[model samples]
Target: MIFTGRGRTRFLDAVTDFETAVRERDGDRAQRAMQQIQRHFGDAEDDQLAQVGPRLAALLPEVPPGPRGMVAVLIGACVERGADAAVCAPYVFDGLAEALGVAGEFCERWAATGGGDFPAPDPDAADGDVLERVGQDAADGWFTLPQWEMASVAMLNRPAVRTALEPALRTGLLDALRAVQEASGHDFKCLRYALVVLDDEPLLALHRPTGTGYLLRMTGIGDNFQLHTLLADVLIGGGHVPGQAPSAQEAAVCRNAPGQVPTTGAFNLVTPGGEWVWNEGTPTDIPVVDDVRLLVLDPPPYKRGWPAGRFFPGMPGDLVLERVLGADETREWLERCAPPK
Candidate 1:
């Protein structure tokens, strides 16, 4: 997705060409346009893909059958990239099972594969049974297929829908996980944490993720005091301050040291030597001084939770070791996926 200056204009024009070709049913022109899409945005940032992929999927009906596969690819890519799949067109899921290379026989494929992870749903049990399940995070995969797609996964009551989506769901997930691991040099599960470096703050957050960050967010450290935890009372302090925000403290243990909130929702965690590691599988086990350990709130991928009021990217990254906060604006690299180096 490297489009700069005139190249940027060409990309936008290509989008228009694709739409026009779709309306006119010109397969050849549409193919060219689709290639442009993949070329210009195939590796785009999740935020960018979030905008384009679902919109194309929603227009599936107009897309030539030959190019519709790409639309499906786009949708799946959005899912894999941790982009907000919620915005995908409702009908996109209507045929997701077939689009994932199942020859339009999701159920048959599921049966043939011997139910990779789940037994085939009983025809009798699915009779008018509305399955209510909780939504799960996309990065963490799903307890149920389409866990948080906001796509018509709610149609679980329909036996056909449930049966059909399984093949595609499983197939797409595994493929995406493989892609994630290959690009990151680690397992998908390990993608949970970004090795954050306050190297600019000259501090280290190590592999501390959101669960650990929340505790740090609320806990105020003081001089010579050991906060009691179930495990033990760990001594923590920032050079003797009882009434000071993290920003006021020294680089030692100061997370929101910049005292300014990040203006964007995208953020990347980096290494102490200043390298992006959030998605590239960079090692996060490096050790740092206890006092220099920063506890910063972890951010969700992209801006999916914005309407849910999670728009703020937290104030901690303002430490300014690198452009951790503005990561999404520039996609020249792997999200700068590391904190700004």
Candidate 2:
């Protein structure tokens, strides 16, 4: 008991010192105090989990960006599988229900089970024929739609966002990020965003490329959904790793398409939001590009719209402007560009 009291007093003192350091903007002192606190606190008896939990919580409020990236990737996978609003909605609902250990009986009853009249053969059909026929017969007075409509109940869940809508949404989102970078002094490729889902809440985290700071928000998925939602959210928000800083030679513009005016050809542009763009603007002119490009494109901006390629704003719908040449053509181009031994 005496040890416990001493531990508590030390923990509180360390916290007070850390907070004071923060108020003073003393990074070094704050870090030292934090390290000291951790050295004593990490090994605290599990019995004190309740009291220490809330006190330590304030130290790191921002969610990490790595998990957010993972969620975005998972959402991308679900979208690729042709998951529509309805299917995705149910899947997310089921996942959340399973996590919370609270099943919706009505929802379960209406859900398609293998033993139901409409089975795998008609999986492609929307809601299968069972619900459709039920709707049709209601108009003829042979049946009546339920007072508690499935769609009405569905509204409560908000469904998983539509997969078809994601690519376009993500594209615009990238543009927003790029625009942010154009106005900042930092390298855009050094920043990234991630969406995370926690039990009952959904959140997002913007990670700086240096991994020093993170911007986190409670967006809905983290507070209301399963941890899987967190995974899905991360899969959806992608990121770019920082590459070697450019040298004066690397910043020099190479020739663009033959007929282009005598502007500084094309050097690599690292935006403030952590994306790379071809320095297509004139060298003397103030370059204004969006920061969101990091989430949309890959290392070399000239590459096609592959899974890892960068996105630009030319297309009205899709994020990709056009597909680049095949593997053979790419190989040949690289070989030609390679410097002589």
Candidate 3:
């Protein structure tokens, strides 16, 4: 490689282009710009990633409302999916709230979805459908549950999310995932996938046993999880061409021992750290020997949580997603990052 390095140059250039597109209020170009942002950020470290906030801060004041809206949709849409962007999330979001004039809505809007005394799920309330249970569990403060744990249980809970999917795609995909778990002799309907449902907002749909998530993006006010699910259905199969901008793909998580996983779809594999062991190809050809996590372009606010949709304070938990990662899991990762304790 050459000098001065890939450092800020690459990441900054992408951000600059994004700023330009947003200033122009060209939704289409802004959307396309996200691809490069995601790619460049993936190649960067904490230093390069750290610059995201300032640029976001500077850009919001320079743009008009139209551009600001583009900024909210595209910029938020891009960074929210990649773990690499974690360093810059606070600034990125702060700028977003400033642009939208909501006085930093991130904490105010999404707090309860994770866990809080604010609008806590009614413990004594009779059982809600699967989603209601999962979302409640996410914020129950009992144990750190996986993000969207209930979603797995609610997969077939259609109109729900399962039935809304193309029948062939859903059935075949589930069978393939089931085969992997079955081969490993651990069956709890363990399949975690993120669905990119487009609306004015960003939200994720999570599965229960065979659960799925929306990987939600936000854009509206006073909306709830139902709104998110509906949007996912609308975006389910429309513009997806597998490998393209504003794309969608199914990523299966292998937590326990992975067995003979049948390759039947476009396979994208990664380590928990996001190192790509495999890339774009067909279902029949993807050959993986070790464990890996999916490297997503639009990661999420945190690794664990239901991604339940956001809502106004004093509202309800219906819109919230369940925890995707559990407490014990968080502790394991945390302990690794700390010194011997």
Candidate 4:
């Protein structure tokens, strides 16, 4: 199952060239790259493709809209040539769900021409049991986050703040959570409450005042259902009571905090050392605060209208940490997480 040597190199080069051609709108170049990609990967055995599944999955996002038909052709060829459905799932199945608006027409054509079909699952089929199982599994192994020593902070879901934070927070949270998992060897099974306050903002803001923990408000143009369900499973294991108010202690923290009134989503992260406030989307030149454990502002993983896939690929390690913690902090975190030399 090893992926290396000239075969891997050739496959990567062909895919990269295909992406480049699509970006440049060079139809001839794209066709050539497509042919080469088919030659290298179209006939690859299931196990061979599975060996490089994650790497292949990483290239899915770069697929351009124009040559999606060609991309479909390549994928169809691979499936026909014995590539496993699991190995091709990320690009073929999940890709259709997530990027359907852009690639739907071509994917349909490919499916009609002997490629696999995309099943439209019943949306309501995702019930409590489904959420619990999937959430627990994901938290246990795949997308777990650290919960120890983490402070909880809930903010009013102001339209402005939600608008600003929506674009970056999902990826940012994912990045930060991954970092925390790497830094601390905890499996984070205790995490039970990542709320997506769509409505009931007034109740949450007035009642549940998370002093300095992970309180999320969903915005942006993507699928809120996917985002909310994913967070609910990881955060509170879907045990949280809807519209529940904050505890007395949490309320005390909110009341004691200065100027903690709800206008639009405005709250400050307070610690024994210092405080940080998120008022709007405008860039702040404030020096990186030591108390701010994690802060990320990357673009959302998929464009608007794309369904959020179950298996979202992570950003590169270096980039993920760099975005939240500056270089110095990232280096320090990495050193602490590094194994003994």
Candidate 5:
């Protein structure tokens, strides 16, 4: 199960390549490096995979904030493919959990005990409805919620925000609801939603009260995928409840919300011509186009690949969008808009 010095060197080289590609915003090269890293782990014996936890933990601090999620994905893939409960508990799961500054005890217990079931839901409980409904919707293959409401919930439910304010109400229901209202910032309140009822365009909306409101429109496909996962996590009780921010060391390596970055207020706008606008707030007066390729309203900031200030040779929004929309079209659009380089 022990990794040979040579094997370790190869793995580290792959990680370095992956990190470099990410920094350079080379999508194809980054993807190739990731696949190589996956193959390296895929070749490992289960016990050797168990040894990977500390190695990953060691590497985590070295990884810049931008690519830490990719590292998490690599680790998760390795564990899912090879590591067992015993192998995962102390090494992989606990290490990641601790780094995130959230309680790892639940995950550690589940891994050690080989329990796959999430916490049991209480139907009679008022506080359980959001989780229960979200879980059911996900299982049913349809998750629908008012976009603004969902954004509010996700922002308020963020671990850092929750930890900062201790509401007087002990009931989870009131506390979460209060958090939602309080978390809805001034800009969000100025917005209004007009639901598009077309069978072909479920979840489509025209937001209003500003010329820039059309930017809030959602694609039924791209957006729902992100929302479904976020909601399902809350339902399953996977995230940490609010508490004091993690220590500097923990926050440095923690993937959850390092530096407690505000999760609300950012919007992603995609034009029919493939131009993307990533704005900190709603942009006004965008001209109507043939078709809007995509619009993600108030996407959780942490999910957007690291905070703004932490990374070098910053990855462009176009490159990030290319990961979602593919390279050929993205490149074509960029070429059309190309400035002297």
Candidate 6:
């Protein structure tokens, strides 16, 4: 359900006011304008509202209450104004489950599966048996589905949103970007970003995707590859394609270290020596230090080797190492690294 160029333009143009309102701390106007945008986008569904309302009410008793109304509002807007099922379903389902007194674990599982209507759990079923069934199903590959693709806005024309932010399901490129941002004590959001992957197999190639100011693409040997391959592919893939993103050329080549070449499953801490490890192996297992003079500490698949340290062919390679550190250390580092405003 990609949005048309006009639709995308409308959204971006309309959102200017909303973003500015948020930035200006005009909560009243911002919230109202957001709601107006939702309605303008045709998100005011009475049935969805009705379904969500009672469900929320029923769960109020058992739950420790906080901002239930806020939850409802968010859910309502997501359903009415959301761009795709991937983006909206999780938010709506998670919210409703909280309001309906559903177990947190169950809700999470349901979101992962993109659940549909289901009968209530049988009271008589053994708890262990239920657990065993779910486990068996997972072991049998129930959870192993094809990697879903989020299409471009020019392709979105349906009632619901097509591509949305899935915080719970980030790709390798996202992880890499996050790592660098975390280590550098800078906001990744301040930079335009993108991820793209060129698959080993033709069918697995990442189709060009259009995004808002940033893009992240990934390719795999198909979905059946080991977890490491998928992660590495995504990171490398992102490095390959910067899309319409700003400073894309720099972001793409920044991570290519010499001996610390990026692999598919390496963990890099952008510290003094370019600390590297396999996330599946050990957190503290620093394999090589000073292997690469400079490191690109984007997110996941922080692989090994430091071959071509630059993305573009002619760029000079600076030996900048990026890493992920603990919260306290990160704060300390940020304080030291702070530049004059």
Worst 10 residues of 4 by lDDT: 312-321
Residue 250 deviation, candidate 5, in Å? 42
- Pick out the ten consecutive residues of candidate 6 with the lowest summed lDDT: 144-153
Off by over 4 Å in 2: 1-9, 46-341
lDDT string for model 5 (1-341, tens) is 45555565566577678767766878688778877777675455556655564455445444433344345445544444443323222332222223222112223333344535433212222134333433332211111112222222222222232233233422333333333334222122311110110112212112111111211221211122222222222211222222122233322222222332322222333333334443322222122333433332223334343222111111100101111223454344334332211
Q: What is model 4's C-alpha RMSD? A: 21.4
Summarize candidate 2's per-residue lDDT along 28-73 as a digit string, tens digits: 7766776666655644444443333333323222212212122222
TM-scores, in order shown?
A: 0.30, 0.20, 0.23, 0.23, 0.22, 0.19
Cα lDDT listed for each candidate? 0.36, 0.29, 0.33, 0.33, 0.33, 0.31
Candidate 1 residue runs with Cα over 4 Å from true position: 1-3, 42-50, 78-84, 98-341
lDDT leader: 1
Is 2 or 6 the stronger prediction by TM-score? 2
Model 5 misses residue 299 by how many Å? 44
- The candidate with the higher TM-score, 1 or 3, is 1
Q: Between the candidate structures 2 and 4, which one is better when assessed by lDDT?
A: 4
2 or 5, which is superior by TM-score?
5
Displacement of the residue 88 alpha carbon in candidate 5, Å? 7.4
lDDT, candidate 4, 1-341, per-residue tens: 35445665677688778768766878799789877777777445566554444344445456543334235434434433344434444354333323222222323333344544222122233345433433322222221111011111111112232223343543444344444334333332212122122221110111013211232332221122233223323233323323222233322222222222211111221212222322211112122333232322221233222222211011000000111224444444333321211
Q: Candidate 5: lDDT over CA atoms?
A: 0.33
Give a tens-digit lDDT track for model 3, residues 1-341.
Answer: 43335744676787878788878876677656656666665565555444564465357555543334333333333333322233323333333223222211212333434523323222333235323533432223211111112222222211123324454654554454344333323332222222222113223222221222223333221222223222322333332222222112211111112122222222223233334322222111212222211122222222221222222221121222223444454344333321211
Error of 6 at 326 (Å): 29
